[model samples]
Target: MTIAVRTFSQLNEAASAIASDRDAAFFGGGTLIMRGINEGHAHISAIVRTTDAEFRAIRTAGSNFEIGAGATMSDVLANRELSFLHEAARAVGGPAIRNMATVGGNLFARSPYGDFTAALLALDARVAAAGSSGGRETPLADLLRDRERNGHGVISHVSVPRPAGGAEMRFVKVSRVKPKGVSVITIAAYLPLSGSRVQGARIAYGAMAPTPVRVAAVEQALEGKTLDASGVAQALAVATDGTSPASDPIASEWYRREVAPVHLKRLLLGQPA
Candidate 1:
């Protein structure tokens, strides 16, 4: 059953409802949850549905924008203010799925399906949430790093500082199909270039790790280097230095390692595969 709530105050009550029952969860579009339920997740008994007007708002008042957790993928794609995320959002499932999948649900996705989180990681976004303990803000990196410790609260929104206009930002989603389904390798890289020299870099790799993770080794290697063949090669060499991709039917650990650097290079240096 789904409990309809219109405000965060009411949402807290709904969240509490979960404790009263053995199995309960917050409903963000119900995409993954419905599948779990159909797959015989009899333990899940209640869902706290969030359709509040505030949750649906696309707030872009200043240089930074806050995306309500309930905002749909379609909302993100259509908003010119959030153009940086448009490519990432469009890279999600097809039109109908995009229309129904909520932004918050995407953040809490299990695996291979979290392309949007990769983009958010590169942008260094922050999350806003509320619970019985009250609301607070947490960096997306921190949440991803300690999800079990920090995810007890319900996410209300995400605060993303817009990337500099001159920074090169690219999202590469490699899947069995284009623009839909789970990605085999999803890379989001942001590099600020001062002429031919690399000023700074933030690279996030998805589906290639247990969680969508930032490659700090590659980032450190690229910063302050001249973007020549040698510098590019060096950075690429350490790109997957510490990553351990899961072996699965879609891709093997060896295959993801082989191709992760290729897509990373392509997204950053415009190298075509």
Candidate 2:
């Protein structure tokens, strides 16, 4: 069957087009959708594309960031203001894939592929999406939770607040292959420090569950604790809690569970893996 492609210059029009067509999918960078089409995953009969300038814009106010859904990984890398995220953006793939993979596409990527989403989760990002019902902003975690049901909506942009003063963020992606490969387990942590003690903490993992998620058990253990070995030990004790990693060609469930604490330890101590 031939696939129909629809292009719109307005986000609302694109949202309506996809929401009204049950078999239509939104085309971001085509990284996932094209692969599905080539592999004969035949649910999609049409694709909606957009060219609205706002759809590709990346803006900042004060220290907060608003990134368009259509912003490519390359775009993220090119912005000096987003340097903190350069490491995660570079992990998307090589230069070619970075040029074609959009932030919106990465949000819906399957396990081992949504490493960037893990980074966004650590930053406590919010996603803005529009559909036939109208537009709304939701936490990234909530959107990821219901992505399958809400995938038809057009994501306009994502909003992220910079880590506050005295706060530190770290991201680590462990893969079987070097430079660019799917994640074995990706860890991102945001720790707010009041002197030597950690206050609220956000820790997110990719390839640790069916989707990227936070290890609340570990976060709770680390509250009001220093980043010293003792605090790290407590975190390691419950590192695998709230996780259900899968066994795949890249790594086994046992292996992912085994190495999660090791990487989390390294991330906490600012050590190299």
Candidate 3:
């Protein structure tokens, strides 16, 4: 079957196009949607895209950093202001895939591939989208939870507050292949410290569940605790408490569960895996 492609210069028009056609999929970097089409996925008969400048813009507002939905991984890598995300962005894919992968598209990526989204989750990011009901912003976790029902709209941008004083962000992707490979598991943590004690810690993992998830049990264990051996040990004890990793060619579910706490411990201690 032939697929029709539509491009709009206006955000609302693009949203309308998608809202009106159930079979028309929004094209961000074309990394995900296009692959489905090429694989003979007949559900998507049309492609909708946008050329609006805001779709690819990246900027900061006070303590918040916003990245447009169309911003590619390469875009993130080139922005010095987004240096904190460089590791996550670089972990996405090699040069070619990075050039074609968009930040918004990453949110819709399936397990093991949404490493960037995992990092965003740790940062407590929010996603903005335009739909038939108009534009709105939702927490990344909420959106991911109901992605199919809530993700059909045109994504506009995603924003995250910059880590505050005494806070640090860390991201790591575990893969069997070097440089670029599907993730075995990915971890991203945002640790806000009060004199060495972790406060309001947000830790997220990819490929550890159907979607990237924040470990509340582990977070609670680490809260108000120093990042000493004892603190790290406490987190490790509950690391896989709520996780339900999937078995895939990249790694078995059992393997992911076994290594999750190991990696989480290493990440917290700033040690190499």
Candidate 4:
């Protein structure tokens, strides 16, 4: 069975229904959910679909971004306000898949799949949600760290603040296909620079760990250093340190470790990877 919820109230009702039933789950976009269901996950007997009016919006004003949970990748690509994220959006899928995937669903996606969430993480995004208890806001990093604890609520919105002055936002993904495909490694970052030196940085890498990871050591290494070839080489070397990735068919841990610095170099230098 599946429930289509049109309003927030209806969404709440559907959520209540799922809470009481072990076999039910919230379905967003059907992109990832259907894959699992087809793989013989018969336990998911019902879904609370989020393709209703309540969760379909893309609002951007000034430097603030507010995307509804159900807003699709197509919506993201079309918004000029989100130019910084356009690269990530294009990396999501082809036209049809992009039209079907939702922003909220990407947040809960497991490793190697949610490259867009990696971008959001680097951008310091936050999520707004409503649970039976009440409404709340949580940092995207915190949510990613403890998915189970913060995931049982209905997501109303995802937001990112404007970067500080002189901050440059960038995204890069290494994929088998240029247009539509999963990434071998994806990197997103916001680098705040002062003159020729980096003051701060938020860099997120996907498919390099159990979840998208940000290397604080890399950020610290880059701070107070010029954004030149020498500085980049040094920071890139530090970027791959302290990572934990399991070997997978798509790419081995060694491969990811070896190339992460290369991708990071490209992203930070604004060169195509």
TM-score per candidate, in order?
0.90, 0.96, 0.96, 0.90
Candidate closer to the true structure by TM-score (higher is better), 1 or 2: 2
Worst 10 residues of 4 by lDDT: 1-10
**lDDT, candidate 3, 212-241, per-residue tens:** 888898899999998877878889999898
Model 2 vs truth, CA RMSD: 1.6
TM-score for candidate 4, residues paired by index: 0.90
lDDT of 2 by residue, 1-273 (tens): 799999998987998898789888899999889989999985788999998988889999577798999999999999998877888898898888999999999998989789889999989998988652444668999988888775537788888897798998889999988988889999989999999998999999999988889889989989999998887799999999999999999999999999999999999989997
- Cα lDDT over the full model 4: 0.77
Model 4 / residue 71 / CA error / Å: 0.6
Alpha-carbon runs more than 4 Å astray in model 4:
1-9, 61-63, 132-134, 148-151
Alpha-carbon lDDT, every model: 0.78, 0.89, 0.89, 0.77
Candidate 2 error regions (>4 Å): 131-135, 150-152
Candidates ranked, most accurate by TM-score first: 3, 2, 1, 4
Per-model C-alpha RMSD: 2.8, 1.6, 1.4, 2.7
Q: Which stretches of candidate 3 lie over 4 Å from their true place?
A: 131-135, 150-152
User: How far out, in Å, is residue 111 in model 4?
Assistant: 1.5
